[model samples]
Target: MDTPSSSARVCGERPFYDLHAEAYDLIINDPVKPWCDAVDAQLARSSSILDAGCGTGRHAAEMIARGHVVDLADAAPRLLAQAAARCPSARTQLIDICLLPTADHDAVMCRGVLNDMVSDGERAAAIASLARSLRAGGKLFLDVREAEASRERADGEPRTRSGFTSRTTWDNGLLRVRETYAMGGDVVEYQFTMRPWSVGSLTGLLRDNGLRNVSVGGGVGRRTPDRLFVVAF
Candidate 1:
């Protein structure tokens, strides 16, 4: 494990992903079958789908196998590369969700990405961008951590997985996460902050971005207890 330099440490989001990309699947491993089931239930056959912020392309690969046209996009280059490798038939772009193309997809699926937008302005821009990326009648499927549930679980316990140990703490409205990777004789640490969303605030944001007919449910798959899954068109 090699630690990031001081400059890399300054920007937590990108650096954390860069360092964790190789072990991301192992550390954050959760079943994608339930998510695919949710997508199948909502989206029509052969729909053009954009897996915005698609980390490692697990869901996008499943969508492609299910006869959908899938595109993978992520701000992190390493993550995007991994996703592209997993889904060679899908177009891959190293772009942020806020900078995605408009009206280019029949549906957009963004999972666990909105929480990374710590500021209100960033969150608004990202959601508006997702809405703009859809064609008329296109749907947006997204999920974020529920504020209360996340707070309850943010006990700062050090949990180890795939040779990485992580701890999370809740502060006001933000989650302070710290991770350490141990390998050989080296130990590397990374830290970042995430903001959970309230139902009222998230619903209002979706409606404000011109997305209508919002449907909110429990988190998909293993995330049901601590997350909120939403669909809007």
Candidate 2:
């Protein structure tokens, strides 16, 4: 389900919300830590922010801790629940970004969601949907995998996860997705889904959606290009 291409309501790749929301953070570390830190440093104060693909509410919690009014929205119901648990005051929504409602936030944030959808068309649509949620001059933040970077992690500690397990096996071009779970109102069965996306392609898509001042920032690990940003209308 690449962006600007596939339909979440139709593709059936498992709604993220229904996935292991309760255990996402336990499985994944701060995938885009640098970006979060940047967001903390450079964002409108007391603004309304939307954590678009807020997985397990990690970033949302960070934003709330910083005093930003946050709306934790995601396609996964279970994930939203977890986010709510982390920040009970945050307004949570179970929304598939590709099919989001009308609203313009002061700022928006999304990470690790669009890349899962493997089609460019679907990815584009999803971003466009996110753009619509932003008001004029509302900044948007998102991160996708850098197509050119290799996923070769140095030999070190053993990595593990819940619900699904993934490993970087391609010389530097594939993300290995494996595992399945049927709970939280959905079923997730996936493995060996490779994604090839580049920074240039992402910038083009953002411009197509009328976003200005798009930029790419540091990713989760200091070693990787984890995210791209779109300062929206």
Candidate 3:
């Protein structure tokens, strides 16, 4: 998958989420466990859950073990391979976020994504779709690095590394990728930009998108305000 160029303010249709599925999975391992653990408690266990952008099926594997009927969606065939391996019984599909509608899931989880990419109109439409997909009181969780925070973290050089996400014949959750970091600082900037979003702005998005009972909370484990929670019908 690809993402928009760094020079633009709005993101184009770059599906970078699946580009380095293994690296993405490693990133998830760092920040996702705690946040998702919280999510496991926030949403009912054993319910139908959707893991949008389930690169390498890391989240899906956990959900399956937790007894969720998980539907994993992504646009990368390679990543889907990883997902299929991780949760052989999971319902998997190669799909784009903009093409899917909501309401079939009790909860949807798309982390370390969404905020970093997605055009404004696209974000609005996606949020609406997510809300539409939820049953009354269903929840959605997403994560993003704040633009303001990105400035603080920017090293002014886009970190690049050489690695690949490959699919093996064995349908098991085996993956490997060399992780790279994008340099950012207080003066850094990005095209698909984001800002440090308070719980209020996030809740506003949720409420504006037809979601209610919104909650803005910080995450544990990582020193980043990575998780944002929302609920809707």
Count of backbone clashes, every candidate in sequence: 0, 24, 17
lDDT by residue (tens digit), candidate 2, 1-233: 33323324422344333434455565566545556677766676777898987777877877787789999877666666778888898988877778677797888887767766666666777888888888888887776666655344422223444444344445335555455554556656655454655777777887888886776655644444444443434
Q: Which is the better candidate, 1 or 3, if ranked by lDDT? A: 1
Q: Per-residue error at 10 for model 3, in Å? A: 12
Model 3 per-residue lDDT tens digits across residues 116-141? 33345655555665566667777777
What is the TM-score of each predicted model, taking all chains together?
A: 0.91, 0.76, 0.69
All candidates in order of lDDT, best leading:
1, 2, 3
Q: What is the C-alpha lDDT of each candidate?
A: 0.82, 0.65, 0.56
TM-score of 3: 0.69
Candidate 3 Cα misplacement greater than 4 A, ranges: 1-28, 157-201, 220-233
Sorted by TM-score, highest first, which candidate order results?
1, 2, 3
Off by over 4 Å in 1: 1-16
lDDT of 2: 0.65
**Top model by TM-score, which number?**
1
Residue 206 shift from truth in candidate 2, angstroms: 0.5
Give the lowest summed-lDDT range of ten residues in model 1: 1-10
lDDT of 1 by residue, 45-152 (tens): 999999998888999999999999999988777878899999999998777677677766889999988888777777777888899999988999997899999999
